[model samples]
Target: MLSHVEVTARVALTSVAHFVWSNRLEYAHDCFVCRRVGRTVSLHPNAENGLCHSSERRLEWQDDIDVAGAHPAPIRVTGFDTAGDETSQRLRCRLAFWWSPFFDLKRPDERASELSEKRWVRLHYRVGCHVCRDAGHDDWFGPQNSVQSNQVWPVTSSCQRCDTELVTVAGPPEINLVG
Candidate 1:
């Protein structure tokens, strides 16, 4: 049998290969309601948030005119753009699926020093509780279901909003590039 160091080195080297090897992951945050891109400002006095209704008026902007006021700050929607096509999408989906906290094993870096380690890993999952699941998202694929989140090894967590324990489990072995 290999010594502990030999085993650790092997695991570390292998886990690195499991990472999605892409240079082109781009992130975006826009208003989910209006699809208004962020980093921009309204050009005119519009319903506290709607586009200016100041078109050369057959009617006119009333002093007390009512319109659907958008959120004081637009509700930020998020998405990413992959540089490559189908292959990249597949790779991303694979990596995302394994990002869950493992139930039985310590994170690879703790067991294998050869692996480069970070203080935290970015993950996007939700505490499956009605209180935490935004205002509306109940079942699956809700905007709040996968908010910006993270985890560390020896994974332990409580709902950020609810203080309930989150159950996490390891799935099939992470995909590795051994060949």
Candidate 2:
């Protein structure tokens, strides 16, 4: 059997509850949960999304946001045709970030009065329950995307609902190059 190819689903702009910055002038993006800096990237680069957005496995609605300083920015989310197909219509402002109330530590590079285990780093993870998905068919019946935090988690996990083993796939495609 042949599987349909759709790489666009993996292309996305990720926004964590908080950003990870480098100790030096360089900026970075990492798996905040593990404090693993895969590589350092620029804050802004002269680039464009060359991918054809004319049509793809994406929402028809797009959000246009304008922010200046701490001001409440005026935002707009609309579709070319609101009354169009439901599958093609979605909002970009999905509430997918969670902040830990116990977030209480400065960046690791920052000097502290004294070294102590009380230090903490906010965590984040992209989780899914393949078993709960019921052989990759159910959507609403499974844990889709989880935004959570804790000191640490096991490298491998189990389906909260079905107890199926879950493991993080090896790198490369799992890391969003466009992100």
Candidate 3:
């Protein structure tokens, strides 16, 4: 059984991931902080946070908009341009299936084996990038190219437009457990 905190974290993380993936806000969007800064927002999926280049703002999973808003802020993985680490995290088995030999079942052996393999492992990763939304540059990062699950955030990145070094820290997200 998972502790209350762990369970809440998992639920929040899943909900945020679902929201981000569904909205496709992992790319060029207005930064949650300085709404004036319009550029590529880096989303660290595994870390459950991201950083915006416009202001070098770090976004967390728990960051929320007001109740009157129709949607929550966008979630993204930072530095999706570069490769990140992948790790396995185990998930609890919630269902129990009893295989009865006498029952007429199609591929009973396969069904039993499938149910028996309830212990699951999920891959987590992390990445980082500078939020350079220069109108001329096309270096945009998104979920498919950038998101990492269960890994540390990148330490350094350069603004694609200004070439200035940006220090990035994988800030602890409200939701710690991904799987």
**TM-score to true structure, per model:** 0.22, 0.23, 0.20
Q: Which candidate do you rate higher for TM-score, 1 or 2?
A: 2
Which segments of model 3 are wrong by more than 4 Å? 1-132, 140-154, 157-167, 171-179
lDDT of 2: 0.22
Count backbone overlaps in model 1.
0
Model 2 residue 140 lDDT? 16
lDDT of all predictions: 0.23, 0.22, 0.27
Q: Best candidate per lDDT, number?
A: 3
> In model 1, what are the clashing residue pairs, if there are any?
none
lDDT of 2 by residue, 73-171 (tens): 111111111121212211111011111112223345532211112211111223345345545545413333322112134233345555555432121
List model 1 lDDT by residue over 1-179, tens digit each. Answer: 11110000001111101112222211111222332222111211122232222212112122232234423332111222223332111212111100112221222232221111211111233324444455463442212221111223234334444454443322211212111
> Which pairs of residues clash in candidate 2, taking residues 3 or more apart in a chain or in different chains?
60-88
Residue 12's lDDT within candidate 3 is: 16
Off by over 4 Å in 1: 1-122, 130-152, 169-175
Model 3 gets an lDDT of 0.27
